[model samples]
Target: MNDQMKVRFFKEARSEENFVEEMCNFRCQVRSDLEERSRLMSEIARRAPDEAGARYLDTLIDRQKRDEHKLVLLKELLFLARVETHERKLDKLDDN
Candidate 1:
């Protein structure tokens, strides 16, 4: 979301194929993040079970779940972006 990143995305979006590739890369990144977060959460849960610790864990898990939900939503958006690329390709082929 910085200006430079925004410009890079704009350039990528200019090419349907490149845009799809970029979206795939982004999706992979989000998936990796979710996996790492899950691992850390598991470790935290295992190490902490005192009354105070449980409260902290509950709060952390709630925030983590929200983040996970956003990542899943992002994956869906990426899928939709790729679908547009496929549709455009099909339209070109049909014209040919």
Candidate 2:
């Protein structure tokens, strides 16, 4: 009812929307990076000098896999946040 409450609520709503948008952008960027890395990794592997070099490349590939997993979790969390906001809106409507 107060101006302060309205501002705080609006800011929270804006922040959540911003968060989802940022995450989506970051995920797209990371996906492109992963594609580039995968392409380069294979090219480098073809010319790798020794076992250690090959192993190091493998490590990089593994790290990329982990990053992909984290991105999936981030998307899930974003979805959950959006669902929570929707539920809150429905509850407010019911209260009215």
Which lDDT values do the candidates have, in the order given?
A: 0.72, 0.70
Model 2, global lDDT: 0.70
What TM-scores do the predictions have?
0.63, 0.65
Put down candidate 2 lDDT per residue, 1-96, tens digits, no spaces: 235433543555567667556657766876787788888788778888589878889888897887687667656755776787688779989999
lDDT of 1: 0.72
- Residue 61 miss distance in model 2 (angstroms): 2.1
Off by over 4 Å in 1: 1-12, 50-56
